[model samples]
Target chain A: MIEEVFAVGTSRIHRVDPRHRVVFAAVFSVQTAIGKEPAALILALAAALVLVLAARLDARRVLQRSVPVLAFLMLLWLVLPWTVPGRPWLTTGPLSASMEGVRLSWQISLKSISILLALMALTATMTAATLGHALHHLGVPEKIVSLLMITYRYLFVIEAEFTRLWRAAKVRGFRPRTNLHSYRTYAYLVGMLFVRASDRAERVYAAMRCRGFKGKFYTLAVFPAGRDTVWFSLGMSGLAIAMAAAEWTATV
Target chain B: MDRTDPIIELKGVSFAYPGGPQVIRHLDFALHKRDRIGLVAPNGSGKTTLLHLILGLLKPSEGEVRLFGRSMRGEKDFVLLRTKIGLLFQDADDQLFNPTVIEDVAFGPLNTGKTREEALAISRDTLHRLGLSGFEDRITHKLSGGEKQMVAMATIVALQPEALLLDEPTVGLDEKTHKRLIALLAELALPCVIISHAFDFLSATTDRILTMENGRIVLDEEMRVHIHEHAHKLGSKPHRHV
Candidate 1:
C-alpha cells in the first residue's frame, strides 16, 4: 500500500543513475553561489532549464512548485532593498532602496531561481528514495541516510492519513471562512495522530525485533559514479567552463 | 522431539508491561532448525511480545529464552543470537529503510560486513529471484504492496538467516498475490515461522500451527489436526500478538 498510487512514466532521465543528476544539481548550485557574473548566472539558468526539458517536466507544474520559493525570494527582494537603504535608488526620504541594493536583490532572486530549478529537475525525474541513496553513496552517514530513507518511505503514509483526516473534516462541516475560529481546530487530530504513530512505532519495533533486528543498521552500497570517478570528473569540468564564464560576467 | 537441541527454546516465558498488567504468561515452545511454524492471534494477545522474547529484544518477565540451546542471559547473548534470525515485519516501510530496492535488499548483508560487490550480488540474486529485476533502481516507497512484500522478503533472503520470522507476511495483498506468496513461502527451503490470521494461507504454507491465547500457547499442532479440531477450540477470544 505504500509503494504508489500509479505507474511512473518512462523517460531517459528516469533511467540514468540517480547520483548523476543529484550531483550535477548540487554542483550547479555551488557554481551559482560562487559565480557573480551574468554569464555564469545565465549559463546556470540555462543548465537548469535543459534539465527540466530533459526530464520532460511541465512548465506549469514546475511553476506551481516554484511559486512558494519564488514568492519567498520576491518577498525578500522587496523588503531587503527598501529596508537596507543606501544612497537612494528609491526612498521615503530616509529608508530608500539603493542602486546596489536593488541589483543585489535581483541577483539573489536570479540565483535562487537557478538553484531551485536545479533541485526541481533533480527531484522531478528522480524519486525521493533514489536521491537519498545517491547522497548516501556519496559518503553521507547512515544515520542521516536512514532518516531520509524513513522519511521518504513513510511520507506517503502520513500524507494518506492527512488526506483521510482532511476528508473527515470536510464531512463534518469544517469550512473555514475568513473569520472562522480554527486555530485549535485540528489539534485533537494531531494529538490522536501522535498517539497512533507512537503505537505504530511500538508495534513496528516489536516487528523489527521479531525479524532479528539488533542495534546495527545495515544497507547495500550502489555508487555507480564512484567506480567511474574519472569520467564524472571530466564531465563536471567541461560544464564548469561555462560556469567560469558566468562568474566572470557577474563581477562586471 | 529433542528439547535439548532446539534451535529456539522457550520455557515458562512470562512478560508484564512495566506499569501495566501481565501481558504474556507462562509460554513454552521449542522450534527445530528446519521447522515451519505459524503464530495466529487476535490484536493484543502478545504474539509480537512472544516473538520479541525469542529475538531477545525484550527479556521475559519470568522464565527464559534460549537460542541454539544457549540461554540469552545478557545483552551479549542477544546480540550474538540476532544474526541467526531473519525478521520481516508487517510494515515494509520500517523493515525497508533503504532508498532503492537493491540497496534496501543489500542492507542486511552490508551491515554484516559484506563488500559492495558482494552486497550487490546478493541484492541482484534476491531481487531476480523475487521477480524485481526491473525495479532495482525504483523507489522503494513507490512499489506496489505485493512488490514491497517481495522486496522485503528479498531482504531476508539476502541476509541468509537460519530461520525466518514473518509477521502477517501477506496481509493487505490481493488474492492473486496471496496465492503467489503462499507458494513462495512453501518453496523456500529455510525454516520459517509465519504469524498471520489467514487460516488457509497458514494451513497451506506451514507444517505446524500455533495460537497464542492470554500470552501462552493455547494450541500447537500440525495443520491437519488444527483444522480437524477447529470446532472444539477453547474460549474463542483470539489472542492478540501485537
Candidate 2:
C-alpha cells in the first residue's frame, strides 16, 4: 500500500544529492507559502512545473496526485467570492461575488499547487530511507529520524496485516452494510489490529535489543555531494532570490 | 571461564507480567558449550518468555540469569552480552527493521562499533555465507517468507556471536527451505537454543529436546531418529504400509 513511485528514476533530479533536494524543497515551499504577489507566485508555479518536467515524472500521475488539492481549491472558489465583503464584481439575487475574495482564493490555490508540485519533484525523488538519512544529516533529531525510518520500514508490514485481517473477515461471510453489526465488526477489526500492532511492537523492541541496539541508530548510508548537487543548490538559490526580488518589487 | 562452565544459566527464574498470571515459575535451565537444544511447548507455555528472560529483555520477578559464568542483573550487563549472543525472533518482519537487506544485516555490527565500510563488509560476507549475496540492495519487505527468514538469520550471523537463540525459525518454511535451514544450522558450530513446535525439525537440528507444559519442562530427552511404517489407503488396497 505504501509505495515510493517517485523514488525510482534515472533523471538528473534523482541523481542530485537528497540533502540538497530536501533543503531546496523546504526553502521553496516556505517562500511560496508566504509570498502573495501574482508575479512571484506564477514564477514559482512555473519553476515547479520545470522541476516536474526535469524529474521525468509521468504527467498523468502528477495530475492524479494534484486532484485532491485541486478539489479542495475548487471548494474554496465556490465559497470565497460569495462570502467575503468587498467591491462587488458580480451580483445575483442575494449573493454578490467580490474581487478581493477572488484574488485571495487565486493566490492560495497557486501557492498550494506550487508547493505541492515542488515537493513532489524534489523531496519525493529520493527513497524514504535516503530522506531519513538526509534529515539526520540536516540536523533533525536522531529520535525523530529513527522514527521516520522505522515507520517507513513497517508501514507495509502493518498494511499487510490489516489486509490479511480484512480478507479473513471477508472469507468468513462478513459483509459490510449500513448497520450496527457492520459498524461493530469494523470496530472489532480495528481493535484487533491495534492489539496485534502492540504485540508486534514488543517483539520488535526485544529483537532490537537482541542486536545490541543502544538507543542510537547507526546508518551505513553515505550521501556524497557531487557536481550535480552543487549546481542544483546554486540554481535553486538563484530562482528563490529572483522570486523574492519579484515579490519585493511588486510590493513597492 | 572454564570450558565446561555453562554458557547460559537460569536459577529459580520466576516471572509474571503486571496484573497477569505467572508465565514462568521456578524454571532452572542451563546451556553448555556444544549443546544444541530444542524447546517445544504449546502456546503460552513460557518458552519464549524463558528466552527473553535469559537475554535480559525481561527482568525475572524472582531469580537470576547468568551468562558466560557471570550473573547479569541490570540492563547495562545485557548491553555487552547481547552482542555475544544472537537472537532470531519468531517473526522475521519484527526482527528486520531496515529498508534494505544489507542495512538490516549490518545493524548488529554497526551497533558493536564497526566502521561503515567494515560493517558493510561483514554484512556482505554474512549474506554470502547464507547464499543471499545478491539480496543486499533488495527491499526487505518484498522478499518471500523463506528468504526473509534466511536474511534474518544473516543479520544475527553477521554479529559473529558466541551462541544463538532462535524462536520458531522454521515456522513458515516449506519442506525444501526447511531442509536448507537445517543444513545451514548444522554448518554453524556455535551452541544454540531453538524453540519450535515441529518435532521432526527439532530432531533433525538439535541434540536434545525439552518439552514444556504450564511453564515447566516436563520432558528432557536425547533426540533420536525414529522411523516407522505408516498405512496408506490407495486404489483397491485396504491398507498399504510403507
Candidate 3:
C-alpha cells in the first residue's frame, strides 16, 4: 500500500515506514564516518546490500542509480592506495602521495554510498505528502512546508498545460535541428509557459480569494502516527546498538 | 409576504464593458422575495454577463443596480454585495480547490474568519442537507461532475447568502440528476436565478422566464399564467414568441 503511494514496486523495502528509512540512513552515514577505518566502511556497504536484498528490489536497478558514485569510488581505490604516503608498503616512484589520503577517499566513497542508498530507499517508499506531514509535525517552518505542498500539488497542473502546448507545437512542425535553434526553442517554450502560468495563477488566486481563502492552507485532521512511531524509534535504537557492537568488535 | 418591499429591485439598469460593446443594455427587472427565476438565452447572448451584473460583480455602465435599496460603488460595496449574493460558476472544478471535499465546503466560512469548529459544523450541516453526510474526506478532484456541482452549491449555501446565482448548473447532467436537482432547487426557498438552455426544464421549474437578446432583456413573463397559458396557445417557445 505504501508502495502505491510512492509509485515503487511492492517489495519488502516499501513495507517499512518512510521515516524509519530516513533515520536509519542518517545513522548509517554518521556512525560509519567515526574513523578512517575500511572495515567499518565495508560494514556500511554490506548493510546497504543486505537492505537491497531484503527489499526485493532488483540489484541492477539499484546499481544503475549508483553508477556515477561507483565509478568515482573505483578510481579513488586505484589512485589513493597507490599514492598517499604513510608507512611505504609498496614503494612506487618519487611521487610520494599520502596513504592517509587513500584511506580517507575510501571512507568518503562508503559514506557517500550509505547516504545515497538510504535516501533513495526512503524516497521510493513514501509519498511526498507523508514526508510533508512528518515535517509539519516535527516543528518545520509552515511557509516552507506549505510552499512545497503547493508545488507538489500544482506540478501536475503545470505539466498538463505544458503537454497541451507541446502537442500544439508538434502539430505545427516544430523540430530542433541545431544547437542555437534548440536553445532558442527552449527559451521560447519557457517564456510562453511562464506567461501562461502567470495568467492562470491570477485567475486561480481571484477565484480562491472570492471563496474566502484568507492566507493559511488547512486540512482535515491527520491520522494518529501510532505503530509507525514505535517502528521508527526501534529502528534508530537498533542502528545505535549496531554501532556500539561495531566499536566493541573493533576494539577486541 | 412579511409586509416588505421586493428583496432585489433594479429599475432601468444599463451596463456595458469598458471601451467595448454593451453587454446589458437598458435591463429592467424586479426580483421579489422567493422568486425562482430562470434566465435563458442562446450562446454569446450575454446570459452569464447579466448574472454577473446582478450579483454586483460588474458595475452598470449607465444605469442603477441597487441591491436591497443601497447603491454599490467599489470594494466595500462588493464586499457587502458578496455577503448577500453568491455565485456558483459553471465549472465546479474552479470553485472547489481544497484537497478534501469537507475542507472545500468549509473554505467560505473559514475565509470569513469563522472558528475552525464553526466551519466544520457548517460544512457538516451543508453536507447533510445535500445528502452527502458521510463524504467529508473524499478528494475534490475525484468527484464526478454532478457531485462536484452539488458540492459547489453546498459551499455557497453554507454561507447562507440571500440570493443564489447558478450559471448553467445542469449543462451536462444525466436526466435523473437533472430532475433531482430541479427538485432540490424547488425545495430551497432562496431567491435564485438559474441560467440554463433547457427551456422545458426552465418552464417546469421557474416561476418566471426571462429572455435576453443582444445583451438586453426582451421579454419577462410569469410561468403559469403568461407563458404556458398564452404563449403556448398563441405561438411557440420564448425565443420564437419574444
Candidate 4:
C-alpha cells in the first residue's frame, strides 16, 4: 500500500539528491506545523502544490491514497468546533460551533496536508533504499537506518506469507465471524506468523554471517548533491523563508 | 596456495543443538582445488548443518574446521575465511536483504572492505556474468523466484570466493533457469560443495555425489553411477528422464 502510494517517476524532483530532499521536507514540515498566519499556511500549501505539479504527480491518486488521513482530519473538523470555547458561529439543537475552533481545525488540516504533499513530492520520489542511504549520510543512526531498510525489504515478504496462510485457512473452509473459534484461529494465525518470521530471521542472520556481514550494512548507492539538487533546495528554502516572514508579520 | 592444500576441511566434526539430537556426527569432509562435490540427503539429514559447520557459522561440538590452510577457531577466523568461501543459502530471500539487486550483490564485497566504486564495479560485472546486466536497480523483493536465485548467486560470486557452498540452489527455479544455473556453475570452475536434493541437477553439475543419511556420509561415488543405479524407487516403472 505504501509502495503504490509513493510510486516514483522520472521528474525534476526525482533527480534531486534524496539527502537534499529529506532536508527540504523536514524544514518545510516544521515551518508548516508551527506557522499560525493563514496567509503563511496558504503559501505553504501553494508551495506544496507547486512541488506536486513539478513532480507530475496525479492529484486524484494522491487524494484517493490519502483518504484515511483525510477522514481523520474530517473527524477533527466535526468535533473541534463544538468542544473549543469561543464566539458561537452556528448552533444545532443543544450544540453550538465556535469560529475559533473551526479556524484551528482549518489550520491543522491545511498544515498536515501541506506536509504530506511535500513528503510525497520529495522523499517518496526515491526508492526506500535511496532514502535510507540519504538518511545514513544525514547522520541517522546506523542501527535505525538498517532497521528501516530491512523492514522495507521484508514487508512484502511478510505480507505474502500472511496472504499464503490466509489462503490456506480459506481452503480449509474457514470463515470470519464473531465467534470464539474464529477469534482463536486469527490469534493462532498471527502467532504462527511471528514464529515463522523469527525462525527465518535466524537463518537469514546465519546466511549474512556466512557472507561476511560484520554488524554494519554497507551501501553502494550514492546520492551526489549536484547543481540541480542545490538549486532545488535553495528554491524550497526561499519559499519557506517567505512563509516564515509572512507568519512573523502577521503576529507583529 | 599449494595445489595439494584443501580449500576446506572438516575433521571429526560433530554438532547438535542444545538438548537436541546430534545433527552431524564425526563428519569428515575435504575439498581440494577444482573439486566439484554434491551432497544429497533427505530433510533433517544435516546437509545445511554441515555447510554451516564448514563455514564456521555453527561451531562443531567436537571438530576442527580448516579453510585455506587456516584453522577457524573464532569469529575473526571465520570473518577472514568467509571472504574466501561464499555460501548460498537455500532461500534467496534469506540471502538477499538489500532493497535493490546491485546493493545485495555488492554487500559482500563492501563488507569485505572494498571501496563503494570497486564493490559496484564488481557487482555489475557479476550481474552481467549472470545475464542480469539491467537488473541492478530492480527491487529485490519484486524479482521472480528464478531471478532471485540467480541474484543470490551473483551476490556471492561478486565476492570472487575461491570456493562456494550452495544450499538447494535450484529449489524454486524453472527448468530453463535451472539449466542456465547448472551451466553457469559449471563454467565458474570454482571448488564447490553443493547441498541439494535435485539429484539430476547434481549429476549434471558435480563430478562426485555424496549421500548423507543419519548424520554420516553413507555413499560416495561418481555422479554417473549414483544416477544410473538409483534412478527409481522400488515398485516404480522405469522411464526415460529426458
Instruction: Provide DockQ values for all models, in the order shown.
Output: 0.35, 0.80, 0.27, 0.75
Docking class of 3: acceptable
Q: Which candidate's DockQ is highest?
A: 2
Candidate 4 local Cα displacement, residue A181, angstroms: 1.6
Tens-digit lDDT string for candidate 1 (B1-242): 24458888899989987897788888888888778888877788887767767887677878988888888896777766686778777777666655677777777776677888888898898777766678888777678878888888888888778788788887667677677777666667667778888777777887887887777887654434244433434547542221
Off by over 4 Å in 2: B218-223, B228-242
Pick out the ten consecutive residues of candidate 2 chain B with the lowest summed lDDT.
Answer: B233-242
Q: Which residue pairs in candidate 4 have backbone atoms (N, alpha carbon, C) closer than 3 angstroms, thus clashing?
A: none
* C-alpha lDDT of all candidate models, in order: 0.72, 0.89, 0.69, 0.86
- CA lDDT for candidate 1: 0.72
lDDT of 4: 0.86
lDDT of 2 by residue, B6-85 (tens): 99999988999889999998888899998999887778888888888989998998988999998998999999898799
Q: Write the per-residue lDDT of candidate 1 for residues A53-111, one digit (tens) a residue.
A: 76576677778778898889878886888866567877576567888778778778778
Task: Grade the docking of candidate 2.
Answer: high
lDDT of 3 by residue, B15-86 (tens): 776797777778777677778888877887788777667666566776776677666665566565565667
lDDT of 3 by residue, A1-252 (tens): 112233355665666555555556667667866734566567666666666665666666677778998898888877886666686555556655565766677678878887667666655555555556556655578778777755665565567678888788778898877789768877888899999778566555555655655576654445354564576557557756766676778788
Q: Candidate 4, residue A99: CA error in Å?
A: 2.3
Query: What's the TM for model 3?
Result: 0.67
Root-mean-square deviation of each candidate, in angstroms?
Answer: 6.0, 3.2, 7.2, 3.2
lDDT of 4 by residue, A1-252 (tens): 356445578788888888888999999999999999999999999999999998888888788757888999999998999999999999999999999999999999999999988988887787788889999999999999999998888888888888999999999999999999999999999999999889888888887887788898776766666777888978988998899899888778
Q: Over the stretch B1-242, how does candidate 4's per-residue lDDT look in tens digits?
A: 56687989888889998899999989888899978988877789899888888887787999889888778898788887787888898889998988899999988888889999999899999999888999999999999999999999999898898999999998888777887898898889888989877778887888888888668876654435344545456537533242
